[model samples]
Target: MKIHNSRLISALFAIAFGAMQTVSAAAETVRSLDDLAFLEGHWRGGEDFVFEETWNGAEGGVMTGMARGVSSGELKVLEYIVVSAEEDAVVMRFKHFRRDFSTWEDGGPIILMLTDAKENDVTFSADPPSETVKSIRYFKTGENTLQADIVLVEDGEEGGFTLVFDRAD
Candidate 1:
């Protein structure tokens, strides 16, 4: 009976330690658009295709931006983006459109909440969690370079792509 009690106590301690670790590992939510100031300015990059993004300075608790992807001198995609400070957290909402201005999403813009923030980097995840795009991250690699990562889930599999942009002339 004593040996059984000792084993049970050990298991309980392990569980408790794990719970504490999880809480510590969780990322803190960012509350201000100022934390993402590194993303400001015009950037352009791509391999076979060229893409450009321009971000305006934050004003009135909000920031606005747009991106255009071009291939062979033809516009392939256009994106409108807005980042705003909410009551509890900063949120980013964006929509994709074709050259003709047809929206990609059917219902509304995709909304992501600021989940993790660090110096020169920030990440946003779908608030309600979507089956499509899971998270978006932007980080500065150098004084003139920024990288954007988009993580997505499809058919029970997860994949992502990274776009590296450099300050445009």
Candidate 2:
């Protein structure tokens, strides 16, 4: 291989500038829990079954929440959720529980890390790629309307459901 001096310098400069751009872009997406204050309120949505979620204001860099589903006037599913601002990234962990307090996620709470954030949207992806959920996204469609998309994966296939909620509080 013949390498010209000018070509070598050009390649080196390209690599250096590319690395800087990558780093700068990544830094722009970093978020803190305070950025998610919109989630602190009551939300209700669902068709066949009524589902409700409530999130508390972020305190000490953490927000705690819970969700439950009711069908036929009977409580069906319950979930405990926590979103925290870590040193490097914001993280969300949630666990589902049955009416009897039995867990649906036998392994452990599903863990997701903040991957993207926009003016009124935030997305968290499975940290290590869980079997049940691949990612979850929350975005505001209107001032009092919010939508949540829960992405799921099974058997190497991708599927998801979206929930549209109105401000309940």
Give the per-residue lDDT of model 1 (tens digit) for 1-169. 9999999999999999999888766534335888889888999999789989999989998999999999988989999999999887888989999988999888889899988888899999996677678899999999899999999888968898999999995
State the RMSD for candidate 2.
Answer: 4.1
Candidate 1 accuracy as TM-score: 0.80
Model 1 misplacement above 4 A = 1-30
The local lDDT score (0 to 100) that residue 114 gets in candidate 2 is: 87
Q: For each candidate in turn, give its C-alpha RMSD to the true structure in angstroms.
A: 6.4, 4.1
- Lowest summed lDDT across 10 adjacent residues in model 2 is found at 1-10
lDDT of 2 by residue, 1-169 (tens): 3568889999999999999999998788779887788887999988788889898999988999999999889999999999999999999999999988999988878999988888778999986779999999999999988899999998978999998888899
- Top candidate on TM-score is 2
Q: Report lDDT per candidate.
A: 0.89, 0.90
